[model samples]
Each structure stands twice: as structure tokens, then as C-alpha cells.
Target: MDVRLFKQVRAACNASTEKVADGLVGTIVEIGGDPLTVRKAKDRLSAVLQKARNGVPQLVGGPKKGEEMAVVISVRDLAELVVAARQQETLGEALDAIGFKPYRGAHILVGQSRKRERLKRSGDAPSAATAN
Candidate 1:
């Protein structure tokens, strides 16, 4: 993927993680603190797995307030995440090779313009506007 599109995807993924953690994405099942509730969830593990297979992630939260949570997702969903992560890593390596530095914000590429200018002066980069 191009740099711009990759940046957008990265931003969206970050937002999605935040939303999921906030219990805004899917069904949240509170466990951990309450022994009975935890036992019930364990007993109903098959049903929860089925729900996840149907594309509804089960957010397993801790019993205490403001604790970290875990998500139960289908293997398909997990594979997608793994693929996206690999693609992001590959693109990041390519960007590093081409002098694109990660900046403060999600969309910003530090020194990008300067790099382009330097490449142009060195006649090592093609001009996209004039290529066609």
C-alpha cells in the first residue's frame, strides 16, 4: 500500500482498538472479580466461541473497574489482524529505506518534502507529475 493509505489504515486500527477497549465495539462480558460470573462464563465458553465465529467479538473484562480486558475473536479475525500487522511492518521498512520518518501525528511523515527535494536535485527520483 502507498504511504497515505497505510497511514489511514493505521489510524483507523488505533481508533478501533480504543473503541473496543471502551466496550463500544461488541458484547462485553464482565468476569474476573465475581467467582460465580466467571464460572458461568467458563460454562458457556462454547456459546461465546460461537458468537465470536459469527463476527461478534466477546470483550472479556475484569471484575474491577478500569481494569484491562481481553477479547475473544474468531480465528478468521485474528488472521486478518496478523496479515495487516505484517503488511504494516513491511511498509514501514520500505518507508524507512526511502527516508520517510514517522512523525508526531498518524498522517505526518517527517522530512518527506525535504527528501523529495533532495532526490529531485540529485536526479535520483522521478517526478510523478511529469511522468505521465
Candidate 2:
């Protein structure tokens, strides 16, 4: 996988959607859903990490270690993001709507292809993948 490309996409989305709150840096924490999913997973993970650092949330009836928190992201979250973006009449339009500037068809194609690759890797083949 192109880690740089992933970073670029992640950075772009983060810059566009993240916001500060409660005097803290908080990005929109998407759970097992799209961009709009509740930030509970992220928040829970953060809480656990924070508590561990503070030596809190003491484990009971077991080792004094921290309680394990499992926050699994579902393939549906990614699918919904792609579906939401692709709902646009055109790839260019969709990218633009997502705050991504697409200068050429090639760029849009690349983006779509990347999304397809992610879906494939996710093992939740989207219907669009079968259409073409």
C-alpha cells in the first residue's frame, strides 16, 4: 500500500473535517460508519489510553493491568463514505463536493480506483465493483 498516498488522503480529510473542542484537539472520529458516524469508538479508545496513562480504570477480578477496549471499524463505514461521495453525478463533482480538487479525469479515475482497491482489500465487494 502507498503509505504516502494514504497519509495524503487522511491529512486532506482531517484538515477538512476535524475541529477543536473543549480546549482540546478533536477530529471527527468516525466509527464503524461513514464520516457521520458517532465518535464513540475514537472517544472510547482515547478514554482508555488516557486512563491507562493516569493509572485509572483499574481492572477488577483480574490482573492489575488495564481493561482491554475493542473498537473495530466495519467495512460498511468505508463503503458509506465511498457511496456518499460517488452519489454525485460525476466523479469530478463528487471529489469537489468532498473538498478534494480534481483537475483531470485521470485524478478522479485514480481516486475511484483507490477506493475500489480499498473495498477489495476490505473483502466487502461493493456492487459498483461488479458493474464494471
Candidate 3:
């Protein structure tokens, strides 16, 4: 497995501990196996992650005055999720927790983070307001 990916797993493990006390919920997972499993998991993980990214949204029409905007979970968030489901139970449980669409193997199809897009006004943004 790539070193960076391993680091990500470690980070996920840490976050999981914070989120649920137990490092990883469910049965104790192995998180390790033959090179093929690691490779496949990583590949599937990447594809699933890419499909979750948001490209600036509809720039053509610009954002609606007050419409909700789509937001993709960060790579790190996905990593945390994947690590929580490691080698024991299937990733389905983790994916389901996060609202990912059903997928084969350890892969999951995640949705955007999505939230209301507040209108921006001159000198009225939160950052500006906080500068008091």
C-alpha cells in the first residue's frame, strides 16, 4: 500500500476514536491482507472518492439567490469512513451510515455534503463581521 494512503488510514483511525470511542466499530478488523486486496480497495476507494468531488457548482447561472448548494465530503472524511469498516464487516455498513449509494466490493458511492448557499453581501460576510 502507498505510504500516503497508510497515513490516511491512521488519521481515520484517530478520527474514529474521537467519533465513537472505539477505534473502529463492529468486529475487530484485520485491515491487512494480500497485496491484491489492498490494491483493489485503494482503487475502489479512489474512484468512489473522485465521484464525490464538487466542481464549483453551476457557475454558468451562478448560485441561486438562496438555493442549497452541493458539498462533497472531503477525501479525509471518506478515508475515516473506509478505515472504520476495514477488514471485518463489509463497507456497506459504513457507506450506509454516510448515505453512500450501494456498491459492489468494498467500494461505496458517496453523495455531496450539500447545504444552503447563503447570499453574499458587501461587507456582510461572516469573516468581515467577525473583525470587530
Choose the strongest candidate by TM-score.
1
Q: Which is the leading candidate under lDDT?
A: 1
Q: Which regions in candidate 2 have their CA more than 4 angstroms from the true location?
A: 1-25, 30-72, 89-132
- Cα error, candidate 1, residue 17 (Å): 8.9
RMSD (CA, angstroms), candidate 1: 13.1
State the lDDT of candidate 3 residue by residue for 19-128, as single tens digits: 43232221112222111233343556654345335311110111346532222345664565566446334476556556787546876769998798888897676685
Task: Estimate the TM-score for candidate 3.
Answer: 0.16
TM-score of each model, in listed order: 0.41, 0.20, 0.16
- Over 1-132, each residue of candidate 2 has an lDDT whose tens digit, in order, gives 112322333334325443212111112122112222234435466654454344222121212255322323234443443454345555765576678964665544333343443325555655776968
Record all residue pairs in model 3 with backbone atoms less than 3 Å apart, i.e. clashing.
71-113, 71-114
- The deviation in Å at residue 80 for candidate 3 is 12
**Which ranges of candidate 1 are over 4 A from the true structure?**
1-9, 12-37, 86-99, 102-132
Count backbone clashes in candidate 2.
0
lDDT: worst 10-residue window of model 3: 54-63
How displaced is residue 44 in candidate 1, in Å? 1.3
Q: What is the C-alpha RMSD of each candidate to the true structure, in Å?
A: 13.1, 21.0, 25.9
Residue-level lDDT for 97 in candidate 2:
69
